[model samples]
Target: MIRHLVLFKLGEGVERDDPRVLEGVDAFRSLDGKIPEIRFWELGWNFSDRPIAYDFAINSGFDDADALRRYLEHPEHQAGVTLWKEFSTWVIADYEY
Candidate 1:
């Protein structure tokens, strides 16, 4: 199994309290059952003061590299990525274990 983790920083002028932020959160949370290759999905919004912490984080599980590749190329995921790009400034990742 492989765990795909991503952390996102919102773009300039994008507030944490913005409604679009919640919409993005919901969109990611909804992908678990909809994407067959996604074994599990979890999302989080940071409310702490950590200097390096991102605004949001997503943790997804896949059965193998092929499953992960499929999830990455899925049409629904592409749409989600498009939506995310609008408000996201930076993205970081960890794709092992």
Candidate 2:
């Protein structure tokens, strides 16, 4: 399986409840039931106030790289990206297990 992890940091001065962030959150949370390629999906807000804490995270798994590619290209995921791109920046890692 392919583990796809992502850590997201909110843009400077952006708040967790900001409309854009809320939309992004909703979009990601909806993917679990909408996308078949996603074998696993976990997404949520971060309550940590520490300076090092990212604002959000996405922990997901796919059957393989092809399935991962399908998730990345899925329209639901793309819509989430649009909202997230406006209010956050993220880093991702993909590994096999």
Top TM-score hit: 2
lDDT of 2 by residue, 1-97 (tens): 9999999999999998898888888989989989999999988888898989888999999999999999999988998998899988999999999
What is the C-alpha lDDT profile of model 1 across 1-97, one tens digit per residue?
8888888999889987788877777777788789999887888887878888788888888988889999989988877787788889656453667
lDDT of each: 0.82, 0.92
Count of residue pairs whose backbone atoms collide, per candidate: 0, 0
Model 2 ranges with Cα > 4 A deviation = none
CA RMSD per model (angstroms): 1.6, 0.9
- The superposed Cα distance between candidate 2 and the true structure at residue 24, in angstroms, equals 0.7
lDDT of 1 at 51: 84
What is the overall TM-score of model 2 with all chains considered together? 0.95
Model 2 lDDT, full chain set: 0.92
